[model samples]
Target chain A: MNSSFRVTALLLCMGPLVSVLAEPVPDLTATLKAAFTDKRQATLDRLDQDETQKLCTQLRDQVPTSELSQKITRMNLATVKPPADGKYLGDWKAGEVVASTGTGLQSSDDPAKPNGGNCYACHELAPTEMAYGTLGPSLKHYGKLRGQDPAVLAYAWSMVYNSNSYAPCSNMPRFGHRGILTEQQMKDVMAYLFDAASPVNQ
Target chain B: MSVQDRYISLVAACTLLGASLSLPAEQTSEEAIAEYHAMFGDENPAELWQLRGEELWKTPRGSRQVSLEACDLGKGPGVIAGAYAELPRWFEDTGKVQDLESRLVTCMTNLQGLPESEVLAVKFGDGEQKSELEAITAYVAAASRGSRITIPLDHAAEKAAYALGESVFFYRAGPHDFACATCHSESGKRIRLQTLPQLTTSEGAQAAYTRWPAYRVSQGELRTMEWRLQDCLRQQRLPQLTYGSDVAIGLTMYLARNANGGEMAAPSIKR
Candidate 1:
C-alpha cells in the first residue's frame, strides 16, 4: 500500500513538470557522470571550469572582447610571484638536460622525480639539438641575438612563470602558476640563454 | 614471441621496400616544393598563434614582476615583428646564430633575473617556461606571417647547422632500429590515417616544417616545434635529446632550408 502511495505521489509531482521541461534538451549529465572512472592521479575534477576557461570554450578561441582579454591578462598578471631571493638565471648545463628529457607527469610518473623541460619538442634552442620541432622558432644561438637585454629578461621570466598572464589564451603552460618548476629551475634555464660560455652562444 | 618476431619481420620488409623505392623519376625537388605550396590556399593556423604570442611578448612575468616590452629580438631590443624571418641568422654580441628558443632563454635570464638552467631544464609540454617558449615562438612567427621560409644558408653556422641536420635525420638507433627516413622517406607512406611526408623531398619538408606549434585535436594541447621533434625521438627510442643540442639545430637547419620559400603557417591547428 505504501509503495503504491509513493508511486502515485511521484507521478503527480512529475506530471506538471514534464510539460515545463518538454522544450529543453534532455540532460545527459547523469550518463556522462556515470561513465566516468577516475584513475590514479587522473580525476574527473579536471572537467570543472573557471570563468575565463568557460568564456574561452564559449568563444572557441575567438574571444571578441578586447576588454575581456585585457581584463584576463591583468587579472592573471597579478597572480604571479617573484623569486624569494630575487635571483634569476641558474646553470645552463643542468637546464640542457632538463630541456632534453620528457619524463615525469602523467599517472605513471613518480611524484618524487623532477620534471623535464622538453624544449626540443617545440622551440629550437640549440642548433646542435637536432630532432627539434618547428612549431616555435629555432632557438639556436638565442643569446647571440638578444645579448642580455634587461627588458628581454623580464618578458621571458614572466612567460615561464605564468603564460596566461602574458596572453589570455596562450597555448604555453603556466609553469610558475602551476608549480611545475621551482625558482631554481627557472634560473638555470635563464643561464642557458645568457651565459656567454653556454652552447647556445657557441 | 612470434608476434614480436613478426613485427621485426614487418620492419625488415619495410626497410627493404623503402630502400628499393625512390622518388618518381619526374618528381623534382621544385615540384615537391610546389606541391607543398599548393596547400597554402587553406587558412594558415599560425595566425592564431601570432595573436596569442604577441600578447605574451611584452607581458610581465616571474617573481620580479616585469614585462618583455624591451626584450631584444636580433635587430634590436624589443622588436618582434619579422625577427623570425632573419633569425638563426648571425648574432654578434654573443657571436652565434641562435634560434628563437635560445634567445628567449637569454632574455628571461638577463631581463627577468631567472636562472637560465631551470628554464632550460624544462621540456616541451612539461612545464611553464617551455610553454612560454611556445607562445613566444608563435608570436614571433606571426610577425613573419606570410613571409617566405628562407633559413639563410649563407652563414657558416647555417651551413654547419644544415650538415648537422642532415646527419641527424639519417642517424639510426633505438630498440626498433629506426631512423627519420623510416617513415619520412617516401611520398605515400603513413603510420595510420596520417600520411608521412618524405622529408627528403622539398614538398614534404615544407609541408611538414611550415606547419608546427600545431594544436592537436586528439590530444587537445598545443604541440611546439620541439615537441614534434621530441615525439619523433621518443618513438625512435634513442637517448633523449638535449635542449639546444647541435644535432637538433642541424636537423632544423637542414629541414628549414629544404622547405625554404614554402611560407610559414605555424601555431596551426591539426586534426
Candidate 2:
C-alpha cells in the first residue's frame, strides 16, 4: 500500500470496530457503471478510463515518478496535430468571442452549436476583464511580453493544444486532443494572444 | 493648459485612484466579499421557497391525499427540528444509509402513498411545473437553521459510506482528467471568479456544506446537495449522477460528518 493508503488504514484500524476496517472497500467502478446511463452528448463511453486516466486516478494529480510523468507527457504530445495549412494565427475578434463563451459539451446545451474555448473561465485574457478566473495565470499582456517569435508562437499553440504535454495531469483541458476546439478556433485564440492590435496585448 | 499644470493634475488623479484602489487595513478580498454578501443576506429569495415548503408539509396531496407531517425523518415521525443537522444517517426502516432527499422520497412513497417512479420522474422544477421535492427540501433544511451539523457514524454502513466518499472525492476520470480534488483540494484557489472550497479539510468542508441547497440567482431555482454533486460531475465531463444514488449519499455522509459543529444555513442564496 502507498503511504496515504497506509495512513488511512491505520486511522480506520484505530476505530472501535476492527472488523470493519478489514472488510475491504467494495469495488466502486462496477457500481459507478451501474449507476450512470447515456444522455445527450454524454454517453456511457465517457466512463471508460484510459491508461493515463487510470494512472492519474491512482496518483490523485500528485506529481508521479519522473518516468511516469514523462510517459504521460510524451503520450499526450503525440496527439497534438499542428495546424494543417501551417497557419498558426486567425482573426483576433473571432478568438475573443470563442474565449468568452462558456457553453458547448454539456448535455443541456445545443449539440449543433460550435464549442467555446471558455478561456476566461480560468485565465485573465484581457486587462479590461475584471471578472476573469485565477486558476490559470493572467495572460493580459501576453503578446506584449512574449514578442512575436516563431518558437514562442509554437510553444503557445502546443500549450493550448495539449496542456498535459508540459505539465502532466494539468487541470487545463486538452482543447485540441479532446476535439473541444477546432483548428481554426485555436488559431484565432493564438492570434488573440499574439496579435499587437488584440486587447490581450494592450 | 501648461505642461507643468497637466503633470500636476495627472499626479493628483493618479494619487486619488491609488487611494481608492487600496484595501482597508487587515481585510482580505474574501472578507470584503463576505461583508458585501452580509449586506444582501436578508434579501435572499430563498424565503419564498421555505414559505411554499411549509405550506406543502401541512397540506394533503398525492394519491392518499395525506400531508407529509407523518413522515419519519429518522428522528421519529414528524420530528423535523434539528434532524437535518444529523442526517445521511442509518435508517433502520430502510436498512440503508439515506440522505435527506432519499429519505424524503421514501417517506413520500410509503407515508403519503405516492408512486416512487412518479416522484423520481419529476426530478427538478422547470417553469411552473414547480418541484414538490425542492419545496420539501427547503422546508426541512430551514427547520435545522442554527442547529449544529452532527452526522452520525455509529452504524458500520455509515462508516463505510464515509470511506467510499473519501475515495470518490479523489477518484479521477473523464476526458479532462478532473476529480473534485483537482480544483478543491487546495485552499485559496478559484476557477474564474468563483472560489473553489477545499473539501478535504474541516474548515473548508464546514464552510461549503452549510451553505448548499442554495437559491441560485442565475438559475432562478433552489438547488439541492444532490443537484450540486450531479452538476459538478457534469462539468468534470462524467455522465450525470443518478439522483439520490449511493454515490451521492456517500459523498454527503463524508461532507456532513466533517461539518460536525457548523450551524445549518441551507436554503442559502448564491450567485
Candidate 3:
C-alpha cells in the first residue's frame, strides 16, 4: 500500500474521536437562558445582561480594570435620581417596618404590595434586637455618629439608592436603580439610620 | 486559729467562684448548632414523613391503581437499601441522568401509569397540596442513611451533566449578577447569622449535601432537594427553575460527586 493511502486511512480512523473531543462546550449564558423560565413576577428578560452586570460577571466581583471600574461607577451614578422634594428623611417608625420586612421581588410574593429594603437581613440596626445579620457593618449608632449632616444624609441616600455608583461590584443591591424600592421607601430607611430617637442610635 | 481557718476557707470559696465565672456563659454557635442536630438524631420530624412514605410505598393508589413495586432505583426492582446513595445516575431506559425526584416521577408515570403532568402538578407540599413525593424521597434517603455517597460519573452524559452543573454554579448573570458561587464558593461567608456553605470544597459539599431532604424548622415541612434548589434560585432573584429539569439534576450531580465518600445523612433536621 502507498504511504499516502496509509495516512488517509489513519485520518479516517481518528475522525470520530477528534470530532467527539472537539464538540463545543455549552455556553454559560445560553445554558442559563435555556434553564430558567418566566414564571409569575420573574420575567425571562432578567436573564439578559446590562453593561454593568456584564462587567461585574467578567470581573467575578473583583475590580480588575481601573478604567472599567470608573466607567461603571460613572454609568451607575448617572442612573441615580434624587428625591424631587429634596427630602432625604421620612418617618423612622415607618422605616423600621420597611427595613424589617424581608419579602419582595420573589415570584411567590404578591406583586401588588410594595417591596421591602430588608436592611435587617444584612445589618444590625437596633442595639436591643438580639437577632440580626452580619453581612454588612453594624449601624447600631449610625444616627448618633453621623448626626444628620447634609452631606452625610446625601451620601447615605445615594448609597441606598444605588450602591454600585460608589463601589462597582458591591454586594448591596441597587434598590432604586433596579426599582426594588420607591423614593418614599428609601427616605424612610434613611430616617431609620439618621433619626436621633431611633433605636439604632439608642 | 479558728479565725485564720475561716478566712482561708472564705478566700478559697471566692477563688472557686471567680474561676467558674470565667467560663463561657453560653455555648459557641458551632457547639450549639451541633447540639441542635444531636438533639434531633434518629427522632427528627423527618421520621414522620419517612413512615408516611413507607406506607405509601406499599399502598396502591395511582391512575393504573398500582404501587411502585416494579420501579427500579438504579438498584433492582422494589429495592430500597443503598439505592439513594448512588442516585443522579444515568438510567439506560430514560437515557438521562435523573436525580431522586426526577427518577421518582419517571417511576410514577412509567410504572404506575400516572400522567407526568399530574405528578409534576403538585411537586411541593403546601396547605392543600401535601406532596407524596416529599415523603417518598425522605423514606428513600433515610434507607441509605449510613451508605457512602458514590454518584456515578462513568458515562459521557454523566460527564456532560457535571460540566454543565459546574458552569451553572459559577455562571454569573442577573439583576444582581450573582451566581451560586457568589454566596457558596467562599469559606466562612454568610448572609446574616445563617452560614453559607462553600460548595466548591469537598468538606463543605459533603456537609451541606448530606443534610438535605431535611425537615426545615422554619417551613415546618420535610423539603426535598428539589425544593431546596428552587428556593436558592428564588433568593438569587433569577427566573424560576423548571422543576426536574436537566440543570437542576446537573447541579445535584456536581455537588453529589464533589461529596463522594461522605456518609449519607439525609432526613436530617435543619434550622
Candidate 4:
C-alpha cells in the first residue's frame, strides 16, 4: 500500500478505539436528580448544591485554597443571625437534652417534634459521657477555660450558627443556619457550653 | 494469683462497691469490638441466608418458569465463581454498568420474566418483610469469598460510571451538609461509638467494601451494599435513593474499583 493510504487506514481504525476510550463524563446533576426522590421531610431540593457545597464538592479530598476558604468563611459568617433579644444563654439543663438528642431532619424523624444538637456524636462535652465521639475537639470545661467574654460568647454562637463561618467544609452541621435547631434551642445549647454549673464545665 | 482469680476478685470487688466492671483500660473500644467478633468464630448466622439463597437460585419460578441458572453475572451464564469480583462491568445487553443486585434484577426480569416491581418490592427485610434478594446476594457473595475485587474499567460505560460514582461520594447537600466523604474520608473517626472508615484511601475502601452484605446482628437481617448506601443517605438527611439507579451503580463501581486487589469477604457478620 502507498504510505499516505496506510496512514489514513490506520487513523480510521484508531478512531473507534479513541472514541471508546474517551467516554463522556456523565452529568452528575442529572444523575443525582434522577437517583434521589423526596422522602418525608427531605425533598428533591435537598440535592441542589449551594455555592459553598458546589465549591467544596469540587475540592474533594483537597483543602480549599486560603483565599477560597476565607471567602467561604465570610459568606457563611454573613448568614449567622444572633439571638434577637441579645440573650446568648438559656437553661443549661434543657441544653443538655438538646446536645444529647440525635434526631432531626432525617426522613425517619418526626417533623412535629423538636430537633437535637447531637453534639456528643462528634464532641466530648460532659466528662461523665464515656461513649462520646472524638471527631471534634473536647468541649469539656469549654466555659470554665474560656470565661464568658462577649467576644468569646459571640465566637461560640457563630460556631453553632454556622460552623463553616470559621472552618469551610467542616463536617459539623450548620444547626442554626440550616434551621436544624431553633433560636431558643441554640441559646439553651449555648448555656450548656458556658454555664459553670453545667456538667460540661464541671 | 492466676489471671482468672484476679479477674474474679476484681469483679467481686466492683459488684460489692456497686460499680460496673468495665473493659480493661488498655483495651480500646475498637479492640473490644474485635474481641466480640472473635467469640462468634465461624458461627456466622449468614449461612442461613446463604442456604436460602441457593434454594432461590436453583428454584424455577417467575412467569417464564425458568431459574436464574442462565443469568450472566459478568462471567458467562451460570458461571458464578469469582464473577462478583468483576461486576459493575459493561453489559452490552443492558448497555449499562451494573452491580450484583442490579444485575440480579435484570436477570430476574429478563430470564425469569419476573416483574421488576416484585423483585425490588422488599429491598431490605424488617420484621415481616423478607428479602429474597438479600438471601441471593449472600449466596453469590459467599461463592466469591476469597476472590479479589477486579472491577475492569475497560468499557466506556464502566469508566463513566466510576467517574460519576467518585463525584457522588464527595457531593455534599441537604440540611446536614454531609457527603459520603464527610464521615468516611477521615481515618480513626467515629459517629458515636461506630468507627468511620476513610474510604478515599485503598486500605480504608477495601476494609469497608469487602465486608458488606454482612449479617447485621443489631438489625437481625443480612444487609447488602445497596442497603448500606441507602441507609447512609437517609442518615445524611438526603432524599431517598432510588434502587438500581445509575448513581447507586456508580457509587458501587467507585468503591469496588478502589477495592480492586482486596479479597472478597461478604456474607460476613457485623454489629
Best by the TM-score measure: 4
| Candidate 1: CAPRI quality band | incorrect
Cα lDDT, all candidates = 0.58, 0.78, 0.76, 0.83
C-alpha lDDT (0 to 100) for residue B260 of candidate 1:
75
Model 4 C-alpha lDDT per residue in residues B1-271, reported as the tens digit of each score:
7544543453343233222113212334465446545644455667767877999999998999999899999889998899877777988898888899999999999999999889989988774788989989899988998999987588878888887887889899998889998888767897667678877767788888888888765555789999999999999999899988988898898888877888999877665
Candidate No. with top DockQ? 4
Each candidate: RMSD:
28.5, 10.4, 13.6, 10.5
Model 3 stretches astray by more than 4 angstroms = A1-30, A61-67, A146-151, B1-42, B59-67, B171-178
Q: Per-candidate DockQ versus the true complex?
A: 0.01, 0.30, 0.23, 0.34
Better of 2 and 3 by DockQ: 2
Better of 2 and 4 by lDDT: 4
Candidate 3: the clashing residue pairs are none
True contacts kept of each: 0.00, 0.53, 0.44, 0.71
Error of 3 at A134 (Å): 1.9
lDDT of 1 by residue, A85-123 (tens): 766678999878776665544434465888766555556
TM-score of each: 0.46, 0.84, 0.80, 0.88
Off by over 4 Å in 2: A1-27, B1-41, B60-65
Docking class of 4: acceptable
Per-residue CA lDDT of model 4 for A163-191, tens digit only, reads 99998889898988989999999999999
lDDT of 1 by residue, B1-271 (tens): 4534543443343334323222222233334334433543343333444555666666777656677777777768888766665556556666665667767777777777767766566445432333656767777766666767766577666676665566456543322223575567545543322456777667788788787666543343456666677567655434344455555555666667777777777666554
Q: B134, model 3: CA deviation in Å?
A: 1.2
